[model samples]
Target: MAGTGTRLTLLLFSALGFWTLWGFPGKNNLLHFLGELSEPGASIPGPTYYPMKQKFTGIAPLDKQLTTLVGFFYTAVDGNRIDISLSFLNLGSQVLAAWILITTESYRAGNKGSFIITSTTLFGLSVVIVGYACVAPIWFALHLWTSKVVSNPRDWNIILEQPIKLAIAPVATLIGFGIPSAVMTLPAPSVISFDTKLNWSALQQGWPIWIYLAQKSLESIATWFQPMVSMRTEKQKRAEMVKYMRRAYLFALGTSAGAHLLYSGLGLAAYFLPGALSTKLQVQLQPENFFIPPNPFSDEKATTLPNGALWFLQWDLVIGVLATMIWGIAVRLSENGKQDDLGAWIKALVEYGVIAAAVGPSGAAVVAVWRRDERALKAKEE
Candidate 1:
């Protein structure tokens, strides 16, 4: 928190938090809905909220908000503007890459400390209570400036990590994040019961905790069956570490690129082959629709359901990516490399553009981290 990087994070993302909040359609009569979460069904059902048109299910308010917002987005897209729905697919991909990257870093040796900073359970729980947009900047800043692994990259002792921990990271990610993401998106009344979907969506909000538990549980099992974990030779350990880290980078790269390409295709179809197959809305989908942030300074409020969704999501992705890029650049700058000249930076930026064009923002971050790991391992070998 004392470093210049930490201060910069606060200055930039704190404003973003406010901008996202500007989408809070005041007078939505949400106070009662929030209050009953602790003792839901304790009293008679009250007024129904917009979009859902049903009483709150007494779940965590964040889960309820996520389910309602996503449901509204799909319904709106189904009715019209299928192109806008495409944005969610792309953004969802980017968010996934960011999540995977952060989850991986949570296990770094230097990252271990206070439960909030290093502890996986506490970190995941915090993100559950506070949205990624709120938690990520602080987390990124802590790593860039304060964490021993990032700050003292060359110190071998700072590299403390269990092989089983690395191996289980991706598995936990799949079970904890991937499955829940898919389950919550199941179509209601047609594919699954709306109430069931709501229940699952609420559960998904605590994915950070789920991922932690999954990783620990898997690690414990691996320790029992593979008791020779600590007996591996140095060469064997190094090779295995490289393999797992490479797998992580590939997973991050593939998911982000896949999502970006999927949605990008959908957006293009809106213009190129309007009414292509069963798609709705033949209106043009502009780049601004995906890249631009809503006017946060306007006198008008985002009082409608669609506008509120757009306002919140647009800022969430835009700000989230920007914060991630800053942290990536900070790490890249700190890595051991030929960074002394202007030519190197221009080449690096060019390479980043090429990767980003194909895979999206999260891919760029993953590549930066991949390169950093390569440099660190190379240094160790030397």
Candidate 2:
């Protein structure tokens, strides 16, 4: 059982790692190639395209020549590759943590059933989350909540509550899903600031802030539904369960906020520092900038705004780390009072963290493949 669990966990992490590398923004050389193809006469620019311009503009005053050199590297390497690589590293860390949790649970239960049950439950929840809630509007309330404007009466409360919950709910949602709601709505600026060019302010007087806050609120509600849908274990008392769940949700919110702050700080530094400083500072450095243009142009000249940097701050690095930690901590605590070997516990923590962080929109895909294989074998035997 231990061997099987370990193998399964490793396999999931491996698949997620591959997806992080290839499926994400940086490693996708094909996306650039395809974009160039789709828009003939338009060539894909590399990441240095912006820094080069900034260097020329005297915006990169310190180490101007170094900034050009850095930009040259970014243009050569695909930005998607950078995103994928960082995601893999972060996911790898998370997987290590999840392994710890699983091992601990196994030791405590004195059997593999608890481990299997927990895995299956998480798998099921991932399916609903990635498939129905994320991909499709199968849930009417969720669909209304995510829509640009809620037309349904049922969604009215969601719209109303979104403002109040913006700061808190996004943090909670990030904890549950590892994806911050803020990223989907916000315009990417360089890591240091958000692009206000097309922001709500451009549309009208108060539209941008209102829309941003509104979307955040909706995202929060959507996130809250995930745990409720995924939770399977029953509590001895319903009230106690509700109380505990609320507390857990709040804790996740706080942890996510802290993680966001950490990631944002790194991204901010990376986006703003002149070329020379990027070389000196490794923590804030992003490899994707080495290959892809900060903004590739097809029709209009690419805007000078720092969208890529903003996206990193809002979605990619910071949110990923927070989500991984939140889920890792939750899973670990769930095994409370379990007497498991330290190694096994460590292994479980690593496994779950990897699965959550690297998989992103594909967690359900992993679960489905596993289930299908199991069913096929079962049917053949029967």
Candidate 3:
């Protein structure tokens, strides 16, 4: 059954990732867009091609793509009101998902089994280049097969959430991911010059690089800052570690839930008080726009650069959410993984549907992880 689930997830994500990379964007669109930017001094085709709005700077294809990414990212914040909300939502969820899925907690004594991939750093460079839709599933599938991280007690026993990591996760998520995003969204000239915003947006594209650097740097800086303290015993240290893990979980819950409410409330406000809000703001805040995804089955291309930008990005968000939900439900840690499996899933699906609708996907994910952790802790205690 585990092998079957693993194979199915692999096939599903591979197909979806291919479609998302090529199907939605179309071959001509990709060629034409890249062709236009292939040269440093290319002519602007039109507004439709305006990543063409920000002229391509680099001569090489990879360099050109990286340069174009700066403007492409900026458009979500500065382009359409609707895309801003969706883009920000995805951005927030992406960071949270990285933390949840990867848990790149720093290496320390007593934390031997921790998953740390330094090549991408903690932030996921592949996620940067290939989109989260593609990278997350591959990562999740690797996790499903390589780590005995199911909901069973014996399986989870080896994967203890380290105390140092639990405390650091929140700090990493906030500073490493959160600060970069906030800077990218700041208003132009008044807050920062237009050029500065673009440059900052350029820097934002390399999140996988910077977040990991920041995390590791923080590890060193934190060592000095952490008050001179020591655990009394092995048992006391383990209990403290559990406490830190729970706090990390709470931090995730609060951040995700707060965002869900803030946006949902604004969306509702836009619905009721349409006259008070600008047309674009209204479009941005509409909850309906938040979850709509490109037709993954279709090869039709987006009409405009901004639409293409949205299309370029949205699948990762949508597919990432789907994959997480599957991981949460399928990787069972219930009291009876074999005996109560079916009932556990049915009940969890219902509960997740309710919570997800109310609080948003990230919020529901936090709840699921928290519950899973609690169950594992209880079983370990017993």
Candidate 4:
């Protein structure tokens, strides 16, 4: 049964990853009739060539409005804005699904810390899925390593909260380390040639790259420490792990939610003051500025997408991290003498629905495993 579940998960990962990469933006296989790319920078002469530019009704009102709005600004930007937005959404969903699926598998295997390692590793690898499919190998490596080590219940509680920390660490590193390093190291002008005549500013334009590099470097350092920390005896682990997990969940949640608001706030401000704010906004949406990591094996960075896609990125990070944090807090709070049977079930079910809906099959599987674990807990108590 476990083997079957693992195989099914592999299939899910392959299918979703392919659909996400192929169906979104540049390689839009699904809507091939709308626009066809004969090759990079080459298009077939046809009636509906690059229909992203054409006026058309979307399936729903919001969709139609969004489509129209995106098309209005698509040509002004360096890259295909609409395609980039949609691609990032697809990419985010792909990562969410993979995270939920792998975490569920780790939970099912009775290795609590394994999910943390697997999810973080997958998060890092998702950035490079464009160049190479390293998901399977990373999964196996983390899985094998984590499986050998059994965590105490107290330690498991601490490990569960670290994923939220892991998620935020990169963003923190970017702001704290990447930006300062880049500012010091980048050339005086900090501008690079985008096109024959166009200049792209590094600090102003390469925010995404800075964030990616910061996160990748920080994640490697953090992940290396996880095993060492996990392996420590109770005396060695007690003080630090307790201090860390107590605040990790809340701190991570606050940062994620705060970042979302900040991004949206800037967008709204930019809309009203385009002349005043347009240059600042332009820095974020600089064309062909997409980040390609230095190496395939150790790092991952999301596609260099348009500014409009920041909303999707915000939603994915905020919601995903928020959900995990809330779950951790609820469980921690319930660590009293008696279990709140109804409350636990209700929370678990709600999470299942949300994850399944937002993330898809993998989420549903995660919730299902949680439900099983809950029932077993109750049975043991009875």
Q: Which candidate has the highest TM-score of all?
A: 3
The global C-alpha lDDT for each of the candidates, from Candidate 1 onward, is 0.61, 0.31, 0.58, 0.36
Please, what is the TM-score per model? 0.79, 0.25, 0.80, 0.37
lDDT of 1 by residue, 216-292 (tens): 89988888999998678767777777888788778888878898787666666655676673532444354455446
lDDT of 2 at 245: 29
Candidate 2 at residue 108, lDDT? 22
| Deviation from native of the Cα of residue 373 in model 4, angstroms | 16
Error of 3 at 95 (Å): 3.6
Off by over 4 Å in 1: 1-11, 22-85, 114-116, 155-160, 268-279, 337-350
> What would the per-residue lDDT of candidate 3 be over residues 236-325, giving only the tens digit for each residue?
656766687678767766666666566566767777888887877877666565446556566666555555666666666667666765
Predicted candidate 2 versus true structure: per-residue lDDT over 1-382, tens digit per residue:
1122322333344344333322442432433332332232432234422212222224444333323222222222233333333333333223223222222222221222333422422432432222111211112112122322212111111111212232333343333333222232233355322223122211222222333354456655656875443243332222332343234333433343333334334444566654534454443355354223332222222232223322322232333333333333322322231112556467645664554343421231222222322333344346
* Candidate 1 to truth, TM: 0.79
Q: For candidate 4, what is the lDDT?
A: 0.36
Relative to the true structure, candidate 2 has a C-alpha RMSD (angstroms) of 20.0
TM-score of 2: 0.25
lDDT of 4 by residue, 265-369 (tens): 444454555566556455443322322111212223333222323322333333333333233322322333122355654665576556544433233433443
Q: Please list the residue runs of candidate 3 whose C-alpha ends up more than 4 Å from where it truly belongs after superposition.
A: 1-3, 27-62, 104-123, 151-162, 225-232, 263-276, 283-290, 332-335, 338-340
- RMSD per prediction, one decimal? 5.0, 20.0, 4.3, 14.2
